[model samples]
Target: MGNFDIKDFKGVIPAVLTVFDKNENIDEVGMRQLISYLIEKGVDGLYLTGSTGEGFIMDSEERKRVVEIVIDEASGRVPIVVHVGAIGTKISIDLAKHAEAVGADGISSVPPFYWKFNENQIVKYYEDIANSCNLPMIVYNVPLAGLLGMNVIKRLASIDNVKGIKYTGMSHYEITQIKDEIGKDFLVYSGCDEMAMSGLLAGADGIIGSFYNIMPELFINIYNAISEKDIEKAQRLQRQAVEIILYSLKVPSFYAGMKAVLRWRGINAGYCRRPFENLTEEEEKEFKEGYKRIKETYKITGVEFLDEL
Candidate 1:
């Protein structure tokens, strides 16, 4: 995203969501408010336009606009890593170059999706993208398309500007394996929100997840507790984090359900784009009640976090 190194960034960085208006266009106002809320709530960094941010659905210019907005709003307060992944290598390269031109801190991408490209082709894709820009690159290991093998990752890591990874799977053993193989200095961020606590203990340097848009402090506190060697506190916070993820999944769509929660907390988190189903009137009521319990009984955070934002 920038002409500098990634700075070995760590701690909780949300793969921040893209707020869309009713017509499925970017809602810049809501997006800025979300970024301000996260930064003010003590998030270490931000991952923009990733899977949770619906990057693939957006056109090249749309993705670039989101990057510009985040870079403008964050204004160097925290590191900003933009996900410039597109199915075509040319599109991804264009996005990565644009990210650097706009002053983003780093750039990241998921491996090619919807096609079973061979290892060599995949490596070449990353190589081209890395070489296209001066920014440090994080290889996104998302299990949805297919888990990238350690051997493949090793090759990808060998790229000069390829600095780290965002592993979306829950395999801590694999995280440790990557650490042992790649050396401890290589940055590895856990992408599963429910497993944030154990993921840190398993050797992940930090976390990047969707839920952080709602309750960043839980993950941040968990990160801090682990650093302080307070196992009990970390465990308690992890459960609270998981409680929200698990219950939120009970709705029609976790993506839409999460936006619903943000609206309840007064963030104007807006709606998920098409094919990511929205909640019905009945489902909306159900989710609202669920959030009330989370706020009062479960004490889900961030309702009070928006005061300054």
Candidate 2:
């Protein structure tokens, strides 16, 4: 905690999609390309090895390797927060220590799930990992791992290095409550994609979402619009994003649909690994057509240049 300010974690960070090859191995070159692309498009930071990065599916070594590759390529251009949440407490600690060793700016983790862990057990789990490294902790309330209650959230936030949270649920009132009841300096990032405008208005310091990997500019526009007090403009852009997200949800998997969109955007973001469906030939075609409908249907803005599909 020497000079680390949790405020650096704010703004439009992508839950960054992990790039993989046809065989679903980590593709280092593709990963570097995607990092540069997002940074060039004005992303504030990168959250690696979370759901979008497919960390839960990868083994410990694989997760550590992904963090290493991203840190080396990013070269400190933006703050990198690695997700260290895993099924085992010791494994999460190991990953957290590795992230600290490789110079990641911060560490985050979803709560351990798949079984019952009492409140104290949960608190100790986070406490152990937070004490493992000097890097600040961003508690990820990403329900894929498990849900974190408000009482547990406050307890965790009270930890020495625990500074913020990635609130993936869709409740702004809760965001407000976290700030008002917890420290006002506490950083809470809205993890839900569709609620960008509302979340910001509700006092979310920043936004981190899976969809940001593909349409970062649109979300950035929403952030700027909020800053400029242009509610009308922000609402319009948020609607466009919601449109895209809803359409992506219709695909075999929203994450896979995002990869397809990334390829369409000229980035070679590969498919999600096994157990997650990659788009079929027919699905890909339908995804493209639905994308075209979005473009025609809305006065969309802030997306970088793209060729017609």
Candidate 3:
């Protein structure tokens, strides 16, 4: 376990992407650069090997290597929460133990998917992982797989080491309910970039999403504005974020579009792996153009842009 408390987990944490080389292997140099970049931009923490990092798509050894690389590169500058979620309980526990061995700050896992799991099974799944190691565990509840209701959330929260949740659903009511049930000290990070403002207002402790990799300063500003009770500024930043997000969706693979933007910034974060196509030449052009417009419209500062680079 790391030295960070639950409070340290609050603020803008990026669900960082996994950089792959031309040969479709994890690019250690590129990954290190990205970790340094986000920390330099003042992101509060890093959520690694999650959906954005394509954790499920990679094998166990690949995931463990990424964790080791990120923790090593971060060098204790910021907390790193590794997503060790796998399809089976044994694999998940193995990953959790490995993360603890490598000195990760925390561990999180999505509930078992693909087959319908009863409430008991879900609770047990989380409990098994949480008990596997000393690190605190966060439950990932996204709407795509299955949404945990207030009752289930309360049950999960009751587990001693089950610390908080990464909520990716759209319901603001649920966010409030989780806080109300678990108390405000229980961390609730907004998993969707599009609803970050709404999530903060609904009492989320912080924001966590793939988009933070693009412009972390903007997201940090949003969190700061919300903390200062500056609703107008928060709304403005969120609108800009939403604009970029909408444009990103125009591409076939949103992650690929993000990688393109990074490459344009001179980061050389390589292509998405197989099954996720890279942006077409035309799509790349459109994305770059739109990204420029977003930067100018929002007057985003303190981050490198493609054109400026």
Who wins the lDDT comparison?
A: 3
Candidate 2: RMSD to truth: 1.7
Candidates sorted by TM-score, descending order? 2, 3, 1
Per-residue lDDT of candidate 3, residues 24-62 (tens digit):
899999999989888998999999999999888899999
| Candidate 1 Cα misplacement greater than 4 A, ranges | 1-5, 293-309
Candidate 2 lDDT trough over 10 residues, lowest sum: 299-308
TM-scores, all models, native as reference: 0.93, 0.96, 0.95
lDDT of 1 by residue, 1-309 (tens): 453357546898988999998789999999999899889999989999988998888888899999999889988888889898877999999999998999998889998888888899899999999999898999999887678999999999899999999998877799999999998878899988999887898899889999888778778889999999999988888887777678788876787887876887788888989988988879888777775676567655543432222
Better of 1 and 3 by TM-score: 3
| Candidate 2: regions farther than 4 A off | 1-4, 305-308
lDDT of 2 by residue, 197-307 (tens): 888998999999998998888899999999999999998888888887887798768888888888876788988899999998888988788777777777554565322
Better of 1 and 3 by lDDT: 3
